[model samples]
Target chain A: MIWGSILGITFVVALIILYEWPKLKQGSKKEKATVVVLTGAGWLLAVLLVFFPEMPGPTDVIKAIFQPLGRYMEK
Target chain B: MIEKGRISAFQMAIMMYLVVVGTGIIFIPGITAKYAKQDMWLSPILASLAGILAVCTAFQLHKLYPKQTLIEYSVNVIGKIPGKVLGLIFLFFYIRMNAGGIRIYADFVAGSFFTETPLIVIISTMILVCAFAVHGGIEVVGRTSQFFIPLYVLFLLIIIILLLPDLDFKNLFPVMGNGLMPSIKGAITPQSWFAEFLLTAFLLPFLKDVNKGRKWGLISVFAIMFTFVVTNLVILFLMGSITASFTYPLLTASRYISIADFLQHLESIVMAIWVAGTFVKFSVVYYAIVLSTAQLLGLSNYRPLVFPLGFLTMLFSIWGVANETESSSYNSTIFPFFSLVVQTLIPLLLLLVAFLRKKSGRRKPN
Candidate 1:
């Protein structure tokens, strides 16, 4: 099941790259690098999430940082 | 420069209206009712001050740096490293912010209607559609918003007008029975929604009629404020004290519309409003994110970054939000403060610094 999810993620990432890579070929090297880096980062995060779904996420950090102010809204 | 397409201030206004009112009307009435009770309708009026302030700050900053988005001008206002850091902070804030929005949208769909559909499917489908809009740039987004506003407004009024018979005017009594504090407290949540007007900082640079930006922005704020006031009153009149009990009071209120049992199940109108408004909202924010990311990275083109960022947003929406309760708690509690600091306070500070620096520069030349 986990491998299936990973494969699914990989397939989607591949399709995005495949569809865009041809267009990126005409753009600057920097733009192409950015596309690779961003998609690669997303792919890594997806795989990591598949493995460790319990890992803390951005909302957790935001909640922690803002909890002091957020407390007033709590019932 | 990255965005070749230009939108008018009126289009910008329409987009901003949807951005605030899209999910806001659905989620906010219940939350505001929790505090404001009978005075929930008043919260949006008071909260609109934040929208005005945000528009003013963004407009003033645009006057100083007329050609650049917030990400680019922050560098000019605050020096390179700090400005870049600020840009990244904004980028992070927006990405997470849009994620929460899309999540709220998915949760609404899945929880209220599509009980059997997978959340990932809903989230991804919405993201995919928004990606096309963002990929089309500001022109596409602006035109789409222009096309949809009338329909959106019509559907909204249809629900309210249909519910007129069921409304009880007495629910508005004891208007301030608990005094203004409860309404003020309720205003806090909606204030964050209003603070989202700071997003105009991005669209302002791409505007064709830059001079009309502030006027249209204020008009948009007033429109959203009016919409919220009307919806809140309608919900308040219909449900009164029990308004906070339902997760989506407006949705429930719309579900109540039954004229001769023929105009029944009008909640689909609410669903239409949600889906369409959220698409524009997400596309606008999504465009901002992609454009700013390209600027921050000094890329020549933003198009390639669109899909990747959309993918990231999808992942982020599903990231920390384990369930509807957690997401709502975050929205009501943490999100308001977080949004205020990032969206409202930070831009105001940047504007002040930009003005001071410009003054000192003029004095040095003299």
Candidate 2:
């Protein structure tokens, strides 16, 4: 199931690049680089999530930071 | 201008209304009821003040720098490096916040209706639709939201009307029996929802009727407050103190409508409005994220970044929390304070800094 999901994730990423690549040709080098970097990062994160589903995310960080105040709401 | 599309202030108003009321209607009544109890209706009125303050801050910032969005003007308000850092913080905050919003939508759908479907499917499909809207630019989002508002309003009214016969007016009694503090505490959650009006900072720079921006924004806030109050009252009347026990109180209220057995199962209407409203909400936030990212990275166009950002948003929503309980608790507690800081406090400070800078610059001429 995990392998199948990874394959699905890769396929979606490839399709996104394929659809967007033609449009980026008219854009600047910086535009192309940013898109490539963002897409690659998304792909990496999705794969990492598939493997380490227990990874602490942005919400965990936020919850940690706001724990003191959040405790007040528990009442 | 990264986006060449222009929307009227009225369109901006409609878009913001849907953005706030979309997921808000479903989630807010229950959450507010948890704290405010019988005084839940008062919470939205209190919350509107935050909305008003957010709109005023965004508008004042717009007046100071008419041509730029919050992301662009932050660099001008502060210095280059710090402004860019602030801009990045705004971008990250928006992305995370939007992801949380989408997660709420997905969880509602999955938990209530599509029990068998995978959440990723639900999240991705919604993101895909929103990406297309964002890809079309600000005008498309504005017009699409405008197109959907009447239907959204009509269906909502239909549910409210259908449920009218069942409401127990006695539930409103002992108003503020706890002496206003519980409702004020309840206002904390919805206040954060209202503070989302600061997103107008992104839309204001693209308005055709710029002078009407603040007027229409306040109108939007009033409209949202009215929606929340009405929904909160309806749920309170229908379910009383039990409102908070259910996850989506309004959904439960609509589900309770079985007038003569023919008008039953109208939760589908609730579901329709939920999906439509959330689409607009996500698109607006998604558009903000992509536009700010392009500006932050100095890209010439924002279109290519849309899909990539959509993917990231989906991932963020999935990774937002482990389950529904965590998401709900976060929404009611930490998310409000986080939203207050980023959306309200930070922008107000930025505006004050910009004013002082202008004053000192004028003194330099002496």
Candidate 3:
């Protein structure tokens, strides 16, 4: 569960930064507030995922992709 | 004057060695063992000869035209249209090769350490790191390789030393029991990897001293050969016949390290070293792709393309194979000939055309 939150947080933060990079380079003041809000939202989501461990969630899609490879190697 | 970066021939050699020897250290032993069995060490020696030939061909081309990259010289050698077409082909090859390397690294990490990590995440993170390094250009890549190569070599030597106790000398016995054909066939897979030294064409123009280029190229090939030979022998000594069955024999061997039961599970250390090597390799290939693309398309700024191209590369790495088995199958079957056409045949053809054009100019009909 802790790992899931870390993944969720990292994914969100990375996406937000990637989105804001081009806008920051473009020097748009209107986009600056949007970037800050998105970043904050990303952080908030991360924290919620971390602390609220019992929150109902969908299955981890990433783990499903890798599980087969792991099983084969283990064998 | 075409390129601003200035790396010494020695730095170029180190960079090339780092790129060539990266993921192969962990995976080649198993791949070769599958074909050559106990004779796996011989495969790299044979592959090294092919590497030498490829490097020598590239060096001769560089010597013929010291100031121009392969992209530029191809135009001077062949007609502009033909040269541009060839350059495009090379650009595509490097792009695919870079993506393939990223895939291999991501797959290995996902298969071993980060069981739950998304392969896309692992691959994208690596591509992000490489894109940043490549944006800094060739000098940054060379210097980084110089700094990390020694440490990588040291770690490799330390691993070999630790595993020495577990090595069974008899496992290497009954040499050539299946005869030389298997080892020869095994050599084909790695020979493609060795031929990657052809990248020196892109790097040669940036080298500080053209004369040392060939010497450094040979040195890089020898260094790669030494690494492969040592790794194959170690896996054979430690895992014996079962080495072929394991996907990553070197990592497994490192995992088996048990000194007083305390020095176990050093696969993370191996992972760290492998990541460093991957960084250098990815940077080199990424830089080559960007520079060659810029040269081909007449783009003044290569920086803007870095992120978009990296995203595409990450996507390709994810989609390149359905699974690890397909990836390995591609490596063993199609990769050698693909590498030969790109690395050896194209460059050799360009060199010959350049020479013939010069000869025809000198002997014009009066």
Candidate 4:
């Protein structure tokens, strides 16, 4: 499972880089920066969520934050 | 100038129908029945007004800026910084909600069809397919929906007609037996759904004939309402109160199609067609986020943002909820109100501001 997941993710990462690298190189600095930041954050989130799913995720955090409000609304 | 593709008002209307019916058709009967029971059909009848309201608000805004999306025109009404802040909020909200939507699709597919497959596979594959369509931009998305919607309706009608033998029309009786309040409760969630026509604001600018945009938009709203009413009636007739028992009442109802025990369990065909609608549904959501983000950030093009946003969407979908109970609970309790504010209330407020700005602009010119 781990090997397959890693291989699949690696393939995806390669594809994205291959498609994006030239565009990034040719883009103005602001466009290049925007792509870099968004892509980097996306990769980080995907890796963390994919490899260690049991770790408390956004829904868990949001559910906790909204739990009190949700209870109040439910009432 | 950001989007080069041009689509007709009719294509926009079809896209609206797909967006409106995407998840609502499959999941609404159970949810509405939970609140309205036998009178579930009435909820859509009344709830359609909100959809009309949403489309009207979108049209008025489109009138003010026939060439701009909500994100782009928002700046022309407000100052640069606040406009950008609004744009940022819109981007995050869409990405989050769309992630939750994608999660719902994954949950349904995983729960019913592919128990052995990892939820991520179903989730990512759907997102990838939608991303591919979204990458083609609005024209491709519009044409794809125009192509698929007829086939989708045909299959849906097939399921409805095949189950006619099993339908108990009396199950829908004791008309409003529970009073109008429960129907109102059912209408509440659907009203939020109707408000989702706010998405049409994004498509309006790219329309070839802005003059007919409102007519087609309203037509699409009525079409959605008609589809909902028919679906709820079909579910009530077929499953009776047992409509609330299954997580996916439409899918369950389709499984009941038995002609000489030969045509039993048409779940595969139903699911395939449903995935088509959902594909168009999520594609629009993805397009809204990517295009809006690019516009907000002053980028000349939006393609670079597509997969990054798609990746973010998959993560949120994975992390959105634990199971069906959580998803439905969120939908019933908090999501309706949230959608009302985001899709209806906020847009209405923006329209007001734009109105004031228009009046002031005329004054200055005088």
Query: Could you say which candidate leads in lDDT?
Result: 1
**Comparison by TM-score, 2 against 4, better one:** 2
- Report how far off residue A64 is in candidate 3 (Å): 30
As for candidate 1, its clashing pairs are none
Candidate 3 shows a clash count of: 0
**lDDT winner between candidates 1 and 4:** 1
Kindly list the per-residue Cα lDDT of model 4 for residues B29-120, writing each as its tens digit.
77788888898999998888888988889899989887999899888878889889888877877887787677777878889999999888
Which lDDT tens digits does candidate 3 get at residues B1-366?
535879999999999998888867756777788878889999999988878888888888877777777777787777789889988888877877787778888889999999999877898789888888987878999999999988899889989999998899899988999899888877877887898888888898888888888988998899899889988999899988888899899999898998998888888889999999989999998998878866776655555556556755654564436677766765665556677677878877777877787778889974
The TM-scores that each candidate's chain B achieves against the reference are 0.99, 0.99, 0.97, 0.97
TM-score of chain A of 1: 0.95
List runs of model 2 lying over 4 Å from the truth.
Answer: none
Is model 4 an incorrect, acceptable, medium or high docking prediction? acceptable
- Weakest lDDT window of 10 consecutive positions for candidate 2 chain B: B318-327
Q: What tens digits encode model 2's per-residue C-alpha lDDT throughout B39-124?
A: 99999999999999999999999999997999999999899999999999899899988988998998999999999999989999
Quote the positional error of residue B235 for candidate 2 in Å: 1.0
- Which one wins by lDDT: 1 or 3? 1
Query: lDDT (0-100) at residue B334 of candidate 2?
Result: 94
